[model samples]
Target: MPHLIPDTGPQRVITASNFVYTISSGLYLTAGVLYFTQAVHLPAAQVGIGLGIAGFVSLVMGMAVGHLADRHGARGVYAITLVVRALATACFLLVDSFWPFVLAVCAATGAQAAGVAARSPLIRHYGGDRPQEFRAHLRAVTNIGVSLGALLAGWAVQVGTRTAYQLLVVGIAIACAASAAVLVLLPAVMPGPVVDGPRWVALRDRPYLLITALDGIMAIQFKVLTVAVPLWLVEAITAPHWLISGAMLVNTLIVIAFQVRASRTIDSPAAGAGAYRRSGLAFLVSCSLLSLTAGMPPWAAATLLMVAVVIHTIGEMWHSAAGFEVSFALAPQHATGQYLGVFGLGAGLAEALGPSLLISLCITWGRPGWYVVGALFTVTGLIAPLAVRRAEYRQRFRPTHIEALGKAPVA
Candidate 1:
């Protein structure tokens, strides 16, 4: 279990920060939209629009902030982003109209994305010899934190009052602030010497960009459980409605139990590609299983849905482990934060677009649509190995990895 919980002070500090940060995220995840509609009393359409704007804004902020970290320093920048998120969360209390709501959400989402990219350098600096595996440990800690935070937010949801909702929002703000404060316990991570290349070198890497694009398509699977399954269960199937929570619980528990174990094997970019391919086929099978649950009776539907979720959860683990491997392995150490920021674009796009895509493909079009979505995943997975190979060829030629092999860099 040391793999699950690393024994070093630095690792523990990072884990603690991630735990608190993700707990705040969990608080917001469950009640964020509801708080605006229920407590602030904004219309649902406005809320949706505001969130959409926030999502797109976040995509650019991460890259910018990450580059900032590469030039200045990571530890302080990461702390600042968390504090910004905290302040933005506090602004939720002041939101009264569409513009105010939009302003708050955009800042909050932007900081959250920025913090993730900014933390990459810190993770690499402190994550021992293998940052990828440490990242896996953080992921497991994240699930535990999110689950606890969700459970805490459940009380507020159950209360169903404006005061209670406001309290939850305030608590989230506190959690974020506390998370930042926790980071001060860790040592500072100074920026590496600025390389004499283009400012946005990561963006210029065409092969890596290809890998990012494919990963983005594969990232849509994230919404399958959170968005698609609940909607499908309610609208299309006869399964008990409680299965929504059941499915989430199942997925969360699986990640908590096995994410570290899963990452143990994906130690390189090529291994990550293989994991992606396996996950794609698993997702296809899971999607197919979920489709079959559509016309079954309640007991049968429930059984099939449960099985689908477990299969999907397994694939999710593989997908995540693969991401950790490739994203960190391929990044230049000097530009780790900035490269990770670029890497995040794929997942950010998936977050922004995945819900709509899943709704249109899986929920709106019915069973046949599941196969289409599954095929897309499988195809993306199958193609990833090639993408990684291209990226590998590209990276080997780059001065970073080449110079590491005791050879003089090529120009």
Candidate 2:
């Protein structure tokens, strides 16, 4: 088995950074909605609208911030974004009305979006030749840290006081500040050689853009698990209410235990494409099983749900592993941040739009909706290899003039 913890200096720093940042995000995510509705006394609609707008703004600005990271160093951009996040989190304390709350949400979400734009470049820079392995280790550490943070947040929720909410928000800000300090300790990775090409080359890469869109579609699994499953169990199936929590627990445990092992084989573009194919099969089977849960006996429904969760978690692991490999492997070394930023749009859009889309399809349309979702996964997974191959071919056969323009060699 590969080491769960990284042995190299840069890898260790990356792992620590992921752990701390994810922990802080966990604490904030668990408490932010409650704080907005209860302590800040914002109506639920206002809160939703404000956050939705902020999320959209973040998505739109991601590529621009990535260009900044490519010009500056990823490490510096990441650290600056952390500090910005800390300040934005602090602004939550001053929110008394809808407009103020919206501004705070925008600031926090924008900083987070920019930070994400910087993150993958930092990882690719520090991960040496085995970025997938390093990413797997960081993912495992993230699960552990987020789990702990969630448990701690649970205690605060149980306290159920305004002061408790305030404390959680304050803790998130302090954590962000501390994480920024930790990032400063990381050795700087210089930006790649300057490329004099058009600033929006990623936008012009058609094959890569298609691959990114497919990635976004695959990411709908997150919404399926979080939104669709709960609604289906409570409304459509005769299963126990606790089964919702049980399914998530199984997913979390499996990911923590086996994600690194699953990622061990994904070392090249072809291998990454193969992993995506496997993930599609897993998702299809899991969705098919889930569609069978309606009108079943409680015991049988519970069993089916558990089985589906396990299968879905497997797909989740493989998809993540393959995504990291393909994303890094296909990106030009000089424009890593820009490409990654563009790639992130798919995930951002999925998270932004997936809940309503999946919930309507799965819960409202029932089994047929699940079948459609399954087909979507299968098609995206199958087409991913073709997209990767096309991109590779383009890179291999680029015009001599384009090559001479200093396209950084792929890693």
Candidate 3:
């Protein structure tokens, strides 16, 4: 037993979370393409509807599942959810009909919801009382997992698309199972002494809600990069497939390296808000860079796209960390999971709506679409700082300056 186990620290948490997310990444990489290919056998409208239904279900039910984790505890919930997710992945091998695909996606989405809900709250619970640092660390770990997943998926795709899908299902099942087994052996949730009264009261805080809304908007950038950018690369610019893949890989690798370090500079809500403001500015600049891509040759466009992605990726990491920190700091003792779930809602909505909106803009505006997206991002990003300022003024409470917040506690 001693030889089998390693030290429990930041590395341990990162490893565990990375394992879970890596599996998730592998599953998602193939699931969408596989479902669509299978869609070729069905009506195109049905395929779209089926995927939409799965996403909607995940968006709605994810909060409920997260709430349950808050009330019930994370360990048992994680174990059970992973088991279910694994079983659902296995069932995908038999999904021949449209209805079956729809149902399978719903199951997988639910599993994803439950799994993330459990994992994030657990990180917060263990990170003493400073939720922001904990949340940032968790995000860093997950991003690292995502990078690893992309690499593995790239290899899987090269083997053969069908073979990749089959292996993805199998790998996802095994990974989920392994994570559940390991998570069960960890310590119980340590959210500190339960203070008396309602944790739901955290929802009423003005700054917290505003921050979450900003988080939702910032999340759209990710939606653009993954869904919108790829389509533009192929259809609009007619760029080579390798350019698209390489750019994404570059973005992922950079994120994994810098997220934690960059996030460390943010300390208080006000400082976070400042970071958010900077993020907004960076986004606008990135969008401007993207707009230039439309006017360039294919190779030149790919280079510009790569540069824009790098800038956008930076803004994403900053805002993501700041958003999590804000949620963790403002959440009441007993309701960390609940408030976090509400924070998670912003992300869920972005995932649901952002892709379609970006894609639509791309299709409708053509070369001009990049500018439209740039304008939207610039406006939204600018709004975040103003909202932060409004929250500061309306509350009549000056946030604690980062100078006095003390050093961040180690994991």
Candidate 4:
């Protein structure tokens, strides 16, 4: 019988790493805020400020870390960052004061950023011609791991003791350490042919940057799910509060079931652009349906919200697949790390700014805000194809050595 998963050693290693890291992240996601406020005894505002500062610092350092991966090696840098992340997470156990907590958070955030910066380059190196599929598999496994971790975290929340929080932190640290060990066992990915250019070449690539910005805008789907929808359901709509958790469950299930299949068609720029267009349409439908839920009977609103979430989840799968395709397709082979780092800025920006933007527009402004978000998706999706085309055109004029990296396979 054929292997159910990828049979290659590197693919297995990478998938395991994703699973372990996401489990660690999941353990923290539901517990971090509580640990800070209840266990560390930090004020809510201080905790938020510390986390915000850490996120900003990580964002700023992402590109430099990517450059480091390029100069050194993606695998080596990735492994080292994982170890650093583990150490930082362990330090959280010692944080009794606000300043100590802030420092630990920053260290963990920076290490995570560096690890993420190296991930795509490592994938590109090992995944051969099918990096998107490999990435999709990793995502699927990550979802499964996170689901398990979240369940475990729920148990910790139920206990809500200092010992529980400490155990969660220790588990995360151990998971990170295990992931680093797994990463070390993978085959080394030799750097691509060096391109002669300034260290910040990605910063000057205007077309690529535009594509990254559009990708970021589409990525607000995450914020929509976690922040906007929960508030909208509880405050704006008369729907059941259970719908929020239901929606998340739907999303996770759909991603696990369909993400890899959706990614199969996204091997080229045009295909990636098409996926973006489909995602935009889905987002528009979901948002439009969601807006109508206000003032409806609870049953009707709940049904509508579920439908909208299904559509939104479909869009999410496509958007993620397209992201992998476009990022890999447009990046010069020699500068993969830098390009991925720059591309990462869109996600960082979305996470940082999406909550405020969505809340201010969708929640505060009511129906008008949802409309704005839908329009934003439509406009960005329409522009993505054009941006990819322009980037491809630019690639045509690059040095012969750069072009030799070969184009993504035509689907």
Candidate 5:
């Protein structure tokens, strides 16, 4: 079958942007695996707290860094964030104790978050009127990088924990530095409008706030499953580590295969809303299946978990791609960076709250606890359809067609 990827246009900027995003994905993937394994070793009570601290810091500071990117230029901000990230990734190698690991993760998280906030809006600079497709392609490239890094790290773990940790740190540092170099090579792309006073007021826009709120709620399923499900597989069901790893590998691979296709298919406002709504429904079903894990035999529970993970992963691809497209369309030509920064805040809060809430529920209510979490997702998904119907949403949103891009207002 033939493929239907979007045109990336003639700018070297798009190519450079993709390369930069690739480095971020690769670095984060390697570092994150190590972080997760190490975090899991700590006392269960402390895990949620540690993740919360890192998330909250990233949420607040990411916006500030992004604000800088909006005022200056994304390329300039990218240059700074990459160097900081490289240094922070290297620090992970030196973290021996729990407290140090916690602190290191926080710094590393902030750097990654800042890089993302800067890069997202930067796409608008390169993409002209086709930011949605451009951003989708960037995300697809990032996913490819993530798969490579995860595979490398997965093998590294088998060799020895310390060896894997050292290799990841060194490799990620190299990637980060290279990304900075790529940013250096790109031409300056200017922000459309220069705000006279404090630009934080840009966040007060009602429509933008509503979309982010919806996004935050959608984040719960992914965060909760990745963190809480693995522990459940091991402690509650006593499944093998290999099974957990396999499930994740499957999830990543499936996403890589279908994500871009799904993105292309659902590039319309109604389609995007439908995907979110369906994803919520899927989450409800997955959680219901997961709840059954408490009642099933070990082998059966592992199988059920795998099934749930697959369904959840598909929904994830739809939700992520659609959300990216919608957010890009909604951003004003002049305030792209500021808008993306605020969007990042919604994601940050979700990352902070989702896992912590799931972990607490799991600790308190045991296996079936996630069902309650699932219900919350179901309720929140309801907002997406409403968002699609609103006139403000339609103003920035459109059907999946070349005509839509041409209609995008250029500064």
Candidate 6:
């Protein structure tokens, strides 16, 4: 099969760096906590609390670091974040207690968040005519990298020893270090010229903030397959437990295969908003399908679950594609990093809170709750286009509009 790697050397370099970094993410996400609990013997509650704090830290750091990237050089700032993440990850060996663990986790998480913001400018610069499409390609590559890393982590988990866990952590640390070194191959991106406007323009742009909020709400769908579907399969349906893995496999494969293609048609901010609307409706239909599987027979339940997963994944792809398009296009080029950083806050909050909400509504509340979730997505979708229009109108009518972020005509 043809690949999604960038054709140019520098772009390919970025793709390589991103792939390596995301591999570490997959490894850590899969087994980092296990290392603490199984190897270090920390209590579960402390781990949860520490992770909660780290989540908040990450959100705050993303914007601050992103602003720094806008003022300073993105490549340098990005490398620093990567180095910090590597160091913090390696420091897991020193975490013997609650507070120490919190420090390490927060540092690593914050660096990860900051790194995302810092890298935005680099992506926008090298992404050719359609940076959004390149983002989709990277997303596809990320799926592959993460899946491979997860498999490696799975092997470590299966070994189930303190030394094995230690090795896994060290491996991810090394991976992060390697990724930072790899980043040096790219050409340096100088700081953008600061223009006359609000220093924290992204924060002051009400339309952008509104879009970010809506995106945050829609981001809860990311949890559906991971948290809600597995639980629903166990509690309400008679489908084999193995189907859990099957569902995840299907999602990963679909994303790797189709994420780029899905983003191809979403060429502008307005199109991105329309994509959001379509994605929301797709989520709604998937939720409806999920509700129907509750009382079905085993084979039927399994089939329905797979079907729903396909629909849900389609929605997920669209939502992500829309995010890439709108977030990048609506943002002023001079402050791309800052805008992306601000945009990330919504998803960050969702990551911290989505699981509990899904547990309470989609899982605990049963089938009826599914409808409520669907309706929420639908309503959000219906309103997004309106927001995009308002943002466009305001920008157009302004006496001094930003050329870098000016919206194109929407059909």
Task: Determine which window of 10 residues in candidate 3 has minimal summed lDDT.
Answer: 402-411
Model 1 lDDT, full chain set: 0.90
- lDDT on C-alpha atoms for all candidate structures: 0.90, 0.83, 0.66, 0.85, 0.69, 0.90
Model 5, span 113-187: residue lDDT tens: 887778766677666555666666666666667666666666656665666667766777778778777665566
How many clashes (backbone N, Cα, C below 3 Å) per candidate?
0, 0, 0, 0, 0, 0
* TM-score of each predicted structure versus truth: 0.97, 0.94, 0.84, 0.96, 0.82, 0.96
Task: Kindly list the per-residue Cα lDDT of model 6 for residues 102-198, writing each as its tens digit.
Answer: 9999999999999999999888888888988999999999988899899999988999999999999998999999999998788888787667867
Candidate 2 lDDT over 379-408, as tens digits, reads 889999998898778667645554453322
Cα lDDT of model 1 by residue, 1-411, tens digit? 355677789788889889888888888898889999998899999999999999999999888999888768888899999999999999999999999999999999999999999999888878777889999999999988898889988998999899999999999999999999998898787667756768999999888888888888999999999999999999999999998999999999899989998999999999999999999999999999999998899999999999999999999999999999999888887788888999999999999999999999898898999999999999999999999999999888888542353211111
Candidate that beats the other on TM-score, 1 or 5, i.e. the better one:
1
Error of 1 at 384 (Å): 0.2
Per-residue lDDT of 1-411 in model 4, one digit per residue for the tens? 022267788788898888889999888886878888877788999998899888887886678888877767788888988999999999999998889998999999989887888877888777868887788887888788888788888877899899988898899899999999888778776665556767788899899999999999998888999999999999988887988889999999888888888899888988999999989989999999999999899999999999999999999999999999888878876677788888988988888889889999999999988988988998888888899899989877877866776532211
RMSD values for the candidates in order, in angstroms, are 3.0, 2.6, 5.2, 3.0, 5.0, 3.4
The Cα RMSD in angstroms, rounded to one decimal, for candidate 4 relative to the true structure is 3.0
Task: Name the candidate, 1 or 4, with the larger TM-score value.
Answer: 1
Error of 4 at 72 (Å): 1.0
